[model samples]
Target: MESDLPIRKIIHVDMDAYYASVAQLDDPSLVGKPIAVGGGGTRGVISAASYEARTFGVRSAMSGALAKKLCPELIFVRTNFERYQELSEKIRAIFFEYTDLVEPLSLDEAYLDVTVNKKGNPSASMIAAEIREKIKARTGLNASAGISINKFIAKVASDINKPNGQKTVAPEDVLPFLETLDIKKFYGVGKVMKEKMYRHGIYTGADLKKKSVAFLQEHFGKSGAYYYDIVRGIHHSQVKPERTRKSLAAERTFSENISSEIFMLERLENIALEVERRLKKSKVAGRTITLKIKYRDFTLQTRSKTLPLYISSKELIMENVKDLLYQDEMRDSVRLLGISMSNLNNENPKKTKDISEKIIDVQLKLDF
Candidate 1:
């Protein structure tokens, strides 16, 4: 089905190996060497790996011990979030120069709707090129961008030519681009979902397009209709600037698993204190308190309780956490523990209106 929606020029900008690159930039000796950030200790997990480390099969979230085994020469560095935030703000400032319709997905990437930009630039492709050049010039770091008709396609295109490169899928090429795309490359489709799609003979965008909405809905439930719409280039999600923070949390992974309740309570005390600090920083309180437990076997479970009143102090937060912690018997040795608060007092309800009702076509030519 051909969409009647107005076409939008969206660009997705993504930093290349942000944390690892930052480390390299600060210390000249670290450049051209394999480095892993935040994977120093025995229980440490890699937060980010340099491309050099990645070549040796190191990756983010991999255990430090395994990463060492993968590349014996891997150098581990501690995460400097304050430095990262400082650089991220600099990059975001460049984005605002073009348009205020910038939606930050994380510290390293964002979606920018440049349909109506400040510079009156007609070509989104040129806008993307200029933004990337500005980022490199100001920050001494490389960024890749994808330009397309909508957020979803733009996000996918950005990865096509990564590590200081870009790809632009024009208004006329959106359908063909998506049709030939590998199903696994579609946003939100993970390993499990990819296997599920493959079982149903859906391996590419073209295969997905052949399936009817009713057929997709019957098998994949609500996501089936989502897939059906996106394959036909019908994503209407806009670039939301003020994305709300839904929850706040703090967690730690232990060097060794502890099965004793006494030891668990000691760890909880520190975790709760961290959560309280974050809550106070955000100036928000929450009614729902959740305890996350990760077993040594890697299985995860969460227990939560909604309170009568919102609370932010460590003493008050711990009171509910202790109750939930002891409420259930120890299933197995715990490798990780976390506390998160939701139903934030500062949350504002948002209602999205469909912007696809108007029929318009995107500009076809690149002026730059």
Candidate 2:
């Protein structure tokens, strides 16, 4: 099966400090300084940080309080997602000039199937270089690319030479490259999984490759086989052109915790409106409404209700959000409130059915 697999030309492109770079490019004064594109106050979390800020151990998703402590001089700017989205569209257009089989992971990264490109460019490496050049010319931002025979290696390779760099892992070198790779560098392995793998003596791809597929499956369930195949350079997932967004919602963290029911309801009204606006922008509705609340003590609670029909109106979303807010008594002062809608109405049935069938087939063979 390994020898029979067809080789493909895949490239993963990732922007360098996308949001922070955009901020710097727009404002000359922000360049070469430690900056983060999110609130940097108590109860706030960073959405993105500049490379300079990263030197001080600041990172996206780190608490704003912690980020401030890490880099005392860190500058905070409000997130400009609309500006980011505009640039993202420009980047995607540049990608389509090379290939139509482009799968976007987010606003900042995407995988392109350049095996058969519109430009008739046989070298994926050259294609990646030209793409990066075009992006810099058009948007004045740097991007990184990883070229390989599959999406897994390409995505991982892109991280090797980041911030206006590129790497190519040819078919013959894929196994050797993967074997020496730290298990933590594997696509699906998280911090917890890394620790678990270390405890199990699976520190590198070489160590992971030594285990039998059945042994891995026994220990890690379905993902075990997935890990086993990826380590052997056997990922077959294609680069899908249209990536459907699963959910859309908006939320906010208050500078001060509020305990008033009326105040909370008022906050939710605006949040619901924002969610509805986003839904309209995306031209999609959702069947499930989820309300998330975080208390001052940091404990989290979520309430979700799925409706029979999908909805995308501010009034309908507010109705649900208000109901959820009052569903349970306020246990403690709330610091954050959010509402998200899922089970979107615009899912691609062909993609969903293909994935479902593949899962069933794998499960049938595994007999677990």
Candidate 3:
């Protein structure tokens, strides 16, 4: 009764030294050299470091002063978030080609459920290999993958072969494989948790697995139940793609105060362009448009319009954005202008709309 959960096929895909790798990919001379991104000034921290820099004690979030002392010749560059985001989107699109059940951990790591995939391939390893290849082909970057019976093993496997490698754990090997896992490597067991585990003589997967769920809960509260289940390779969580996107809009602070209506229209034009660019890149469109304006005194006002159809076109977007801007009350010298869109069309209009309420309640249900 305890072993009835279906044999799951999960893959964890992680980019190797993601930020540093992207920098290296763009510059051939940087390859095989120690490089760090961020930390240009005296009081800055390193965002990421290449494998070469890591050998010299450089690490993410390390102070620039400390990192420089560790590696005299460490190369540092500013973080290019826009480029990083673009590459992330490109890589994510490749993953979608194989499976929609991708759960992105960050820009660099994600867990994928390949038990059921678009390619219909029974082999998760094959799908992983294809994804890795596509990423390299499209973006000129290397990525590592791990495949296993569940998310836990797959995540652990992905890091076993670092830089550019993969590992797989079959269902039958789960227990023995986890038996040898170090206490520190167990998910959710951090530095403090490690000390507690050591105190309890829980040094390995086998030690932790031996503790009753009730006993562990008594000792560790809510997390105890989690560790107990994972030690025995039990994780019932689904691959959730329920990611919520926050802040779908952007605004700007003007360099100068401008009063001309024509100038305001022109500023709104540029803002609209950026909004449309973001919408298309994210594969999203909105039914509403909003206009915000600020006067020289810093007082602000806004007006909005909701359309009957979802819009992504640049020209039409600006038209509605302009309308909203005009509708706003204007009294003083306008210093800043902004445009935004929301009220998304959750369903694609190209597809058939949902059945009418009467049809859904009567014909469809009754017919079935």
Candidate 2: tens digits of C-alpha lDDT, residues 200-258: 89999999999999989988888998998999999988887767789997999998999
The numbered model that scores best in lDDT is: 1
Between candidates 1 and 3, the lDDT winner: 1
Better of 1 and 2 by lDDT: 1
Candidate 1: the clashing residue pairs are: none
List residue ranges in candidate 1 displaced over 4 A.
Answer: 349-368
Could you tell me the C-alpha RMSD of candidate 3 in Å?
A: 10.4
Question: TM-score for each prediction?
Answer: 0.90, 0.92, 0.68
Clashing pairs in 3: none
TM-score leader: 2
CA error at residue 122 for candidate 2, angstroms: 0.8
Q: Each prediction's Cα lDDT score? A: 0.91, 0.89, 0.80
Residues 1-368 of candidate 1 have per-residue lDDT tens digits of: 37766678899999999999999999989999999999888899999999999999999989999999999999999899889999999999999999888899999999988887889889888999999999999999999999988899899999999889999988778789989999999998999999999999999999999999999999999999899999988898888876777899999999899999899989999999999998997788999999999999999999999999999999998899999999999899999999999999877756454232221455435431
Model 3: per-residue lDDT, tens digit, 1-368? Answer: 13556666788999999999989988889999999998666656788999999999999979788999999999998778798999999999998887777789889889887776688687888888898989999999899998887788788889889888888777777888888999888767889999998998999998998899998999899999888888888877656665544325656555567788888778877888888888887788888887888788979887888889888777998888767767755788876677777876544335333221111122111000
Off by over 4 Å in 3: 245-368
- Please give the lDDT score for candidate 3: 0.80
